[model samples]
Target: MPSSLMLSFLFFLLSLSACSLKTQTTEPEKISHINKENYMIPGINHGLIQSPINILSNEKHETKNHQITLHFQDEIKAVENLGHTVQLDFSKGSSISSDGINYEFKQMHFHTPSEHLIDGMTFPMEMHIVNYAPPATKNGIPHYLVIAVLFKMGNENEFISEFLTLIPKQSNNTVKLEKGRVKLHDLFHDDLSNEMKNYYHYRGSLTTPPYTETVNWFVLKHIIEASPEQIRAINDIEGDNARHIQTIYGRHID
Candidate 1:
């Protein structure tokens, strides 16, 4: 081959190598930027009303009396160790109605180190009683009404003690329970109606994935009590799975 042709061929190979390196370097950087943006400000990617916001207890806001009614069977059929959290599954035929909108009780799950902060305070544990209502129209979004209960380290909680030992040892494992063995009524001291009366209601999303912003959050004003050992046992299984607090975004807290 001619000397000039050989030099030109070498230059072409070097240019191709440089372009490949440039492409490899910039691609990861772009992905890193996106991940960082999502981590720093989740609302930019998700919706405005996100779950686990810091609730300000002292803030004054307009309130409306929502005629809430509870028709609870309190029958827990199974207990699941989901790796992410301990869950208690309720049997069918239990529902709650607020202002004529009915939401059926599905299941309840826990979050360690509490998700929603009260007066800028995080409790030892939090339980979310998840309820759902189908969309009114085909194009309408599904609705969720999550009742949150924060637990502080104190006396052992009766409701938790019922199923704490019954939780399956392996992750994703479920153990069937005898009917009335693991009742949700025990959690509310057999008075769910009264316990639900004094709560701070707001609009938020699920703390977990999809983070859909159609949740009607009812964080109980009264913080419940649980033993430190019980809380630690649950945290050990779930680890630290609490989503960081999101901005309130001018949402009402009644």
Candidate 2:
């Protein structure tokens, strides 16, 4: 039998070895470096502002409903430095999945001076209504859905007048605005044509700093009409609020 000192020495060695192994195992994996040119976009430059793009088509498109409704309450006011983001309690503005899947509307926000360019044209503003699905599906899958709407110049944008009135005129990034219920019908126009129903959809990351790639983008084919005054009103309220567009990264535009 080994002497007591030798036995103690061996035990110490084993314990040291075990500690080394544990340290190696606990080290976190290195984060992969991402190239900004390959993933980021530098949005509109600080140049003299140009007049609104007058591009339009006589083409009409059929419209469909996603069954979303939102009610603004006293508690849904704006927050500071965060722009205007309203959180709907429960599934207030969410879409119901008949496929036995449940989803909830987390919140809604906007991007001024446009984010997504359609056919090489940028709109005055864009809004994103974010939704999160329930737990994993039967196939062990979970997903998020984001509906994006582009606002342009036109007189038919009266639907947004009430909402716009809540925007604060100060240069502060965030502010508290009155809460009101905004129904799905309030945002969507029913006079769209069949041709306008087609949209450009693809996997994309959020258009903000620390841009996350967890959004399922559904961009409408037809741009919603907003008066030039409406566009200026929002811009005046939230100057340079939009983030730069990110690279498509060979990502398929479905």
Candidate 3:
């Protein structure tokens, strides 16, 4: 009877050992099966992180490879109405060209009720001067350089008076550039105050859809003054044409 008991105990021990080995071998295969799904591992870089961006200061100023010449055209040849935006096409304008960056003015557009906010304050309106350059000069960068002009409430800006008249009440409408030939040199007067100082520089995406993040923003410290009447005129065209501010993404302020 004792011998029979011993044999039975041995058989039970062998069965238990075999089951443990089987479990160990199959566990790795189960993990391998999950790995084949090509799932992203946890802790990957998701868009959840909102980085804090730094505002640029004068100390961080660097030499701009490209310079722009502002021109005033008395008579516009064509006015294209892009819905929510308007363009004043010019035939000719002078631009400061460089080997690294060469920019030519394509057109000028406007956004009412302002698009950018300084310290959470909105301006009356903003003007965008669009320029284009070849990829070679831009180091294969795919972006259109836009110069933004912010307007605040003040005395009327003489150079901008005629340009504001052509803004259509409706979106996607085109108006002819009436009047005579507008000279570019006359638009930008010799105002020492107009120089861009105390600019906040940062890398940002375009506010428009497709949201290309190739733009380097240089928001001037001083606000340009415009007459209250001009602000009222812009409000007539667009009650709310500006976009919400985008994320700075923890970028360092210069």
Question: Which numbered prediction scores highest in lDDT against the true structure?
Answer: 1
**TM agreement with the true structure for every prediction:** 0.81, 0.55, 0.60
Residue-wise C-alpha lDDT for candidate 2, range 65-168, written one tens digit per residue: 43333332213334333433322222344353312445465656666777776656777788665666754657643445666778877774755664565444
Native-vs-model 2 lDDT? 0.51
Better of 1 and 3 by TM-score: 1
Per residue, candidate 1 scores C-alpha lDDT tens digits across 1-254 of: 99999999999999999999976655322433333334545445555667888999876365667788889888888999999999999899999988678999999999999999988899989999999999999998788999999999999989889989988889999999998898777777748889888888887788998787778899988788999999999999989889999876556678
List the RMSD of every prediction in angstroms: 14.0, 15.2, 14.8
Shift of residue 76 alpha carbon in model 2, Å: 8.1
Cα lDDT of model 3 by residue, 155-174, tens digit: 88776676677666677777
The alpha-carbon root-mean-square deviation between model 1 and the true structure, to one decimal in Å, is 14.0
Measured with C-alpha atoms, the lDDT of residue 179 in candidate 2 is 48
Candidate 1, overall lDDT?
Answer: 0.85
